[model samples]
Target: MLRPMGREDMRAGDSDRKTVADQLKTALDEGRLDLSEYDDRLQRTYAAKTYADLDGLLTDLPGTVPVQRAQVQPHTPAAAPAPQTASPARQIAQWAGPYGAVIVVCVLIWAITSASAGHLTYFWPVWMLIPLVFGVCGQWFGKGGPHRR
Candidate 1:
């Protein structure tokens, strides 16, 4: 008769290896492991065959527990969150508020400079409209956030 598999002897899967790889990446990012050490641990992590093999790789890392076999749980459907949509006016106002302020400021500066010079300045403020144009287009055409596909 086949013996039952112990927890430590459970076969590791891609998800398991991925979890350990994430931890190793965190360790490296946090300066817990140097590049060479992290590289070695990462190699070993992917090659690990069982929970027992994966467990020891993270023993020295702080805030880590031994990898355990994942338990199966009953599947339950979660309630979907209600979709939020903004009114057309509200969407316009959102982008318009900042853009309007910037345009007003730029135009005011241009007006003052033209008044002092007795003619319209080169209208350098027109350059400021570039970003506002892009923002307006993004607001109207972008998917997601009041315009989700």
Candidate 2:
């Protein structure tokens, strides 16, 4: 009898997400697939939680459109993370990372929790600058952010 598959062990049999993502990503980067379609497939593939689903997605990829994958040494540090700041929407998502959650939490604690506790009421107003600075830094230095990308 076959043993049940472990949750984490469940993955593309031979194909890996990174490889597949890289493949699709490379193709998209090379302009082989239509931009809109590339976005769709990529979004679908990543959204897929199972290998079976991923395989299904790729089955339709070759005929959908063709693009070349650039050879990148895995050992090399990834280039700042993103490329082509063509759309404002893409820019927004890209810059939303880099510990935004933690920063927001910290800001909340400083602005609301701490201020309420009377630990830092004097400087609570400075929290107003948090979002602005975060926005500027994220725009310029975030991994997937604008300009840096």
Candidate 3:
């Protein structure tokens, strides 16, 4: 038989802290908390060590629920972890894949135009290529890309 949860005596874990933090963020987003107050409460939420402590922080927030520690059953393995977002390199590759095709098409068009004109035109393709190169370099080096929230 399992014992009932007694909130006062229960210890909080990382997940519990994260849950309350998420709720606090929602409250902040909803304009319930100003910047300073939200920052203070967020700090306190992470510092909370017990379920009772977490409960106190959320008492004033609507729809907030007390954190409950997850229960484990014997003979069952834990569920697989959630899929991770693609890494920066993977994201860059994915973006580059189609963009590379576009560049190839642009080069083909430039080649056809030059061959028909019987002389090389000014490298107009460099206009397209310059920005693309800079953008990719920015994604590679600038703050780890804009996809990061």
TM-score of every model? 0.50, 0.31, 0.42
| Better structure of 1 and 2 per lDDT | 1
| Candidate number with the higher lDDT (1 or 3) | 1
On lDDT, the leading prediction is: 1
State the lDDT at 46 in candidate 2. Answer: 68
Q: Write the per-residue lDDT of candidate 2 for residues 3-104, one digit (tens) a residue.
A: 998543465543455556777877777777788887887777767666655664555555332212335456877569665445544565555655466666
lDDT on C-alpha atoms for all candidate structures: 0.85, 0.61, 0.82
Q: How should the candidates be ordered by lDDT, best one leading?
A: 1, 3, 2
10 residues in a row with least lDDT, candidate 3: 64-73
Candidate 1 backbone collisions, by pair: none
- lDDT per residue (tens digit) for residues 1-149 in model 1: 99998978989899989999999999999999999999999999999998888989999889777745336579998999997877655787877898899889989999999999999879998888888777767777775235564
Higher-scoring candidate on TM-score, 1 or 2: 1
Off by over 4 Å in 3: 1-5, 67-149
Cα RMSD of all models vs. native, in order, equals 6.2, 18.6, 12.5
- Badly placed stretches (over 4 Å) of model 2 are 1-15, 60-149
For model 3, the local distance difference test gives 0.82
Model 1 TM-score on a 0 to 1 scale: 0.50
- Global Cα lDDT for candidate 2: 0.61
Candidate 1 weakest ten by summed lDDT:
140-149
